[model samples]
Target: MLIPLVLLTALAVFRTAGALGVRRFDGWRVSAAHAMAVMLLFTAGAHFAPPSVTVMPNSADLTAMVPPQIPFPELVVYGTGVLELAGAAGLVLPATRRAAAVCLALLFALMFPANAYAALNGVELAGDAPSPLVPRALEQVLYIATVTWVAWPARTRPHPAAPGRDADRATGAGRRS
Candidate 1:
């Protein structure tokens, strides 16, 4: 949504301004990785929110997105929430970042059905006004693009190693065999 777009853009700017570290953010990859991870985690947390609250799409709404044939739509939401959390964590780690991005990208693709249903049905998400079909479509496209940015090969490793960390890599003294 617009929230993620703005957040990611702000992060990229901060990185470019040298607030994040010495090695600047590579515009999309690093920025998207961190920003999307945060966004995922945010959304995942909403799944556990009380039903009385309307901060996110209601369970009934989400359930409606599932085909009637699916036995338990609530389970789907819960499961996807867990998956998003795991994926979010993966996005922040070096070894798993790329793999996570791939899976999250696929998840975004797989999630389209619900999104389409919402758009067509005029379902507002996160208390936001119902997004028009064109905007909804554009959002999907942006989601894919953000995932691509997150999944893209790191142009400059996204971020530099922590202070003294790169040196450790050179010596291997801190590592155990």
Candidate 2:
């Protein structure tokens, strides 16, 4: 929990700084995108920590708690970690950003079930109990909103021939004049 919160704080700070720098210094979209990608990578990496046997019992315990459920918890955890890393890498490059954003949105959705389980079952963390389900649900909703905002497309480059394209249109560039 602390790890994720710390990573999220860093991401917010870097995002703000990047937005300010890009707006003021100009021509910084690629740099900003890269910074965002790195932040996400760190955030995603935090999730791979071995499950808390104390808080979240082992697979056997989980089965006891909620029996007849999916059996491969380790696989789920590692697979999610790998996807997150890949998505973070994809977001850093301009050519793959859009695809990365879509993947990240899916990832967020995919993780919701685990979050729900933790909240519903009162899964404890290192020192504290699980958060209230309502707040936990709201937090997930906020995460989804953030992902959506980050994924929204914006024009990164000024159009060439800004003035001349209008003139060309008046002179019937698209038609016989």
What TM-score would candidate 1 get against the native? 0.71
Determine the backbone clash count of candidate 1: 0
What lDDT tens digits, residue by residue, belong to model 2 across residues 1-177? Answer: 443475466566665666677442233344444545665666555445444544433433322222126566666656666887887788666678777778877877777767677768876554467667777667666655555555665656756555576767876675664
Candidate 2 vs. true structure, TM-score: 0.63
Model 2, CA-based lDDT:
0.59
TM-score of each: 0.71, 0.63
Give the poorly placed runs of model 1, Cα more than 4 Å off: 9-17, 20-28, 126-129, 154-177
How close to the true structure is residue 131 of candidate 1, measured as C-alpha lDDT?
69
Clash statistics: count for each candidate: 0, 0
**Residue-wise lDDT of candidate 1 within 71-119, one digit each (tens)?**
7779988888888899989987868887887888788888777777777
- In order, candidate lDDTs are 0.71, 0.59
Assess candidate 1 and give its lDDT.
0.71
Q: Candidate 2: where is the Cα deviation over 4 Å?
A: 1-8, 11-39, 50-68, 155-162, 165-177
